[model samples]
Structure formats: structure tokens, C-alpha cells
Target chain A: MLTPLFEAVRPIPAIALVPVAILLFPADEQGIVFITFAAAFFPIMVSTRHAVRALPTLWEDAVRTLGGGRRHVLWHVVLPGILPGVFGGLSVGMGVSWICVISAEMISGELGVGYRTWMSYTIVDYPAVIVGMLTIGLLGWLTSAAVELAGRRVTRWLPRAEEAS
Target chain B: MTLGITLESLSLGYARGPVLNGIDLTIRPGEVLVIVGASGSGKSTLLRALAGLLPAHGGRALAGDEEITGASRERAMVFQDDGLLPWRTVRRNVELPLRLRGLPRGERKAVAREWLARVGLEGHEDRLPRELSGGMRQRVQLARALAGAPRAVLMDEPFGALDAQTRAGMQALLLDVLRDTRATVVFVTHDVDEALLLADRVVVLGHGGIRTIVDVPGPRDPAADRTALRAQILEEL
Candidate 1:
């Protein structure tokens, strides 16, 4: 039921919706936050749906035969089975959120790395703009790395075949 | 305690059509009854019905006096592909049924460990399913199934994917384990030799029904000459 709506909204770039976000929200911060959330939500939702669908029926059968009900199957089989895929989405979502948040900040009024960088560029402060750009890059890399680290911790059971070699 | 499964005019199949029709059989308590047949002969279907994984198209299946309507912990199933959860450690996988049964964490851990030891998977308990060899994974599956102490075990070609040497070792391990428990076993295999070796009675299924039920004579000896019996089962297939 929600697929058609999601599909329609998914193709519209979050960055492209800044004007609409400004119209909808009372504050620039709220608009920026909304765009960031929108940018992250789609990838995570899509990956989670695909992950749930791709899970093998055998695992559910195994759980059921062991006297597990629907709740047990959800806890033991479905949730863990989709962790890897969900994490994949989360990592991608983090990166996309960074892109949108930075872009939104640059386009709107406020204080952030993107706003600072834009301000420095307008003022022709080359060194300050470079510093602001570096700060944004560092922040993006750190957030992505944090998400990936958390993903690795929860999905430790996954075989790192390439790493083994 | 072991369970005696009764199939009274049980018919099983998917939505398309019936696969096994009007099947009637009584599996005695504590007996290893192996069902053998060619591919698509409904051996696995019959096993699935016994496990309550598949519903009967007609009539009823009974475990003792209770009608088999759905899956229960009383009838555990082992599959050709080891169904151990990929994310769980070997010990945790074996402890799954116990967890489902609402056993306390301490008791679940103890029972899971004991069963892991029984299946010779002691040192590998902490490892995930993907880390284990095929044979090792199957061992973990066996431990997981038997750890629940189900009254009956319904196996659908559980060892069919293993190589000859590993299969033989698994067979020996299974025989050893069977001697210790009274769980009624309904094993489905395409190999006639496997049926003869493991079964107290072999049911040959063909043409959507039981073709013949052969009683394997004597003390379940592997060394005994049975060329004639082998030929008889092969001919039925």
C-alpha cells in the first residue's frame, strides 16, 4: 500500500526540496533536519524490505518445528536474518544524510560546516573556506565509519571470507 | 517417551494437486522407520506431514491420541540443508528449542553443551554456522534437533548432501545416538542401502503411495550380508 507513495517520493532529490522544506517548516534547522531524515529513510526502508523478503523459508520452518510461534520466529529468525542488509542500508543512509544535511545548510541560513564554508567563500577567505571544507569531510568520514563499526559489531557472525585470505 | 504416529487415509500435496494419496501407515513407538523412494516420489512430503510442516489434504495424522494439526516441539525435523541460524553460535542454535520451551538460561546452556558434546562439536560451540565445515554444520543440526528431546525425529534426507565418508561417519554417529534414546525416527532417503542400514522397517514409496513395506531382519548389523535385501529394495524403487 505504501510502496507507490514511497516510489514517487524516492526519486525526488532531498536537496531539491529545500524550498518546499522552507515553506513547510517554521525554522531553517527544522527544514534541514527534515531533508536529512528524508534522505536517510528511503535507503534504509528499501534495504530492510528486500532483506526480509530474501530470507529463506527454511529458517522459519525450523523455528516453527521447534514449537516457536510467530513472535519467536520474528525474534529469532527474521530480525537477525535481516541485520546485515539493514546495516548495509544504515551505512548508505548515513552517507546520504551527510550529503543532504551539508547541502541544506549551504542553501539555507544558519550555522554549520556548509554555512561556514559558504560564508567564507562569499567573503573570499580562501584559507577559512578550505578549513570549513576539511571539517565537513572529516565529520562525514567519522559518521560513516561509526555506522560501519557498529554494523560490524552486530553482524560479527557474517563471514569475512576476503579478510580471512 | 517415543511417539507412535498414525496416518489414517492421509493425503498430502501442494495447491496444484495431490502428491501422496490415501496413505495409511502406523509408525510404532521407538522404531526407526526409513522411507525410501526415487526423487519426486513423495517421501519428503510424507516426512513433512509427520513433522506437521505440511497439512494433510484429507483425513488425519495422529501423534499418540492427539491430532497433528501443526508443528510442535514433540516432533523435531532435521533437513538435508542444516537449518542452524547463521547469526547464532553453534551452542545458541542447539539451545533454540529449549529457549522456545521457556527453559531457564542456565539449564538451556547446560543441555545445549551436553548435546554439542554428544555430537562431537564441543570445541566449536562458539563458532557461527558459516565458519563450520559441511559435516560439522550437520553435526550441529543433529545436536540442535536431539537437544530438544523430541518424541519423534522426522529427517528429510539429512545426510544426503554429505560426501560418502562423512555420510558414513554421520550414520554411525546417528546409530550410536539412537541406541541411547527412544525417539521414534522417520528418516527419508533415496538410498536403499541407507534405508536398510538404519530402518527397523523400510517403506518404499512410489506412484503416490506405499509400494511395499519391508522388515529388515535382526540386530541392525552393518557387516551382515544383505545383497538379496538390497536387490529387493532397489527393484521396488
Candidate 2:
């Protein structure tokens, strides 16, 4: 049911929303942040939805027959079932968020990596643009890694690295 | 004490139409009843109806005199797929029922350990379900179902996917466990050999209500002088 909405939202490039964001938001900063959130939200939603939809129907039946009600099943089964995929989505979402946010900033913003890159280009400051690009890349990598690390910690019951493969 | 179940004019199916029509039978407490049939014969449908999974079509199932409105702890089901939560360890999966029932953690752990051992998964307690072989995973599922000490265990082709040797081993393990516990079992399978080995009374389901319910005499071995019985069942199917 929610799938079609997600489908419609998933494919359109976040950069396509530049005009819409500029018109909707009162300030460039807020507009960029909204774009960043939009970019992140769709990937997470789409990935998590697929994860949930792909779960075996029998697993829910198993819980029900064991005297688990709907709430019980959600907590003990559904949430745990989707965590790995959800975290995977989070990792991807973080990367895309950076992309959209920087693009929005470059289009129209006083500061941020994207704006800095654009300003450097205007002044022909090639080295400063490179540094901004590098910093953005580092931040994105660190955030994604943090999410992956958290996923590993919580899902410790999963088989270890070698056994998983 | 184990619980007996009665079904009266039970019709079951999906939204399109009824797959199983007019299933009326009583499973005695502590009895091992195996239902056998070809595909689309509604054997699995009947099992699901009894498990309170299939919504009421024309009639209802009763646990003793009480109508089975929905799933309850009295009836636990073992699915064809080993429905182990991938995120939990084998021991934790077995402990799930106890945890749901709000048992004290220590007692739940002990019971989980005992049942895991019974299923020959003693040392593999901490391992996740993904790490286990298909046969071992099925064993863990069985242990989890039985650990609840439920009155009835409804199994739908729990060993159908295993290799012949592994299927035989699992069948033997199930029989051993069933013999030791008081839980009544309604095992569904397409394999005639499996039905004969496990059933005290083998029920062949087809054309709606039970096609036939045959009482197997002592020595429930497929290799025994059961050619006559096998022929009779095959003929019915």
C-alpha cells in the first residue's frame, strides 16, 4: 500500500528539487537542510519497506501460535528481522544526504562544503575546493561507519564474520 | 495434561473459496495423528484450521469444548520452514516461548537448555540460526515448539524439505520426543512412509471431510509387513 508512494519518491533525483526547495523555504540554510532530509528519508523508507515486505509470512505465524499477539510479534520478530536492512539503508541514506545537502548549498548558500566549493571555483581557488570536497567525503564516511558499528553491536547474536560468509 | 481437539464441519481456504470442506474429527489427548494427502488435497489447510490460523469458513474448531477463536499457547505450530529469528541465537530462539509467557529468566534458560539438548543441539546453543544446517535448524524449531510444553503441536510438513536420511533422522527424533512428552501431535505430511512411521492413526484427507482414518497396529515401521496397509492408503488417496 505504502509501496507506490515510496516508489514515486525513490527515483527522482534530489537535485531536481532545487527550485522547489528555494521557493518553499524562507532561507537557503533551511532549504538545504530540507533537501538533505528528503534525500535521506526516501532511501531509508524504501530499503526498510523492502526488508519488511520480504520477511517470511511463516515467521509471523510462528510467533502467533506461540501466544504472541500482534504487538509482541512486532517487537520480538519484525523489528529484529529488519534491523540489518534498516542500518544498511541508514548507511546509504547518509551518503545521499551529504550529496543533496552539498548540492543545495552550492546552488545558494552562504557557507557549507558545497558553497565553499562553488565560491572557490568562482575565484579560481582550486586547492580550497579540493579540501572542501575531501572534508565532505570524510564526514560522510565517518557517519556511515558509525551506523555500521552500531548495527554490529546490537546484532551481536548474528553469526561472526567468517560464519556469516 | 494434554488437550484434545474437535472440529465440526470445518471448512477452510483463502479469500477465493474453501480449499478444505467439512473437516470433522476429534484428536484425542496425547494421541499422535498424522494427516496425509497429495498437493491441494487440503491436508495443510486442515492443519492450519486446527491451529486457529485459517479464519472460520463454515464451522469452527474446539479445544475440548471451547471454540478456537484464534491462536493460543495450547496449540503451537511447527512450520515447514524452520521459522527461527535470524537475529537470535539457537538457545534464545528456544527460550522465546518461555520469555513470552513471562517465565523467570533463569528457569526459561534452564528449560531452553534442556530442550536444546533433547534435540541434539547441546553445544550449539549460542550459535545463530544461520550457522546451523537445514536439518539442525529444523531440529531447533522442533525443540522450540516442544519446549513450551503445549497441549498440542500442529506440524505442517516440518521435515518435507530434508534429504531422505536427514528426514528419517528428524522423524525418529520427533517420535522420541513425542513419546517422552504428553503433547498431542497433529503432523501433516505428503510422504506415506512418514505418516506410517509416526501416526498411531493415519488420516487421509481429500474431497473435503476425511477420506479415511486408518488405525495402524503395533510396530509402526515402514519396513515391516505394512504392504497391505500402504496399498490401502494409496488406493484411498
Model number with the top DockQ: 1
DockQ of 1: 0.79
Residue range with the least summed lDDT across 10 consecutive positions in model 1 chain A: A25-34
Q: Give the docking tier of candidate 1.
A: medium
Residue-level lDDT of model 1, residues B28-120, one tens digit each, is 999999999999999988988888889999989999999999999999999998698998999999999999999999999999999999989
What TM-score goes with each of the models? Answer: 0.96, 0.90
Q: Give all candidates' CA lDDT scores.
A: 0.92, 0.87
Q: For residue A85, what is the lDDT in candidate 2?
A: 77
> Rounded to one decimal, what is candidate 1's iRMSD?
0.9
For A1-115, candidate 1 gives per-residue lDDT tens digits of: 9999999999999899899999998565899989999999999999999999999989998999888999999999999999999999999999999999989989985978999
Model 1 spans with C-alpha error above 4 angstroms: none
Q: Write the per-residue lDDT of candidate 2 for residues B115-190, one digit (tens) a residue.
A: 9989999999998888889999999999889888899999999999999999989988988898889799999999
Cα error, residue A69 of model 2, in Å, equals 0.3
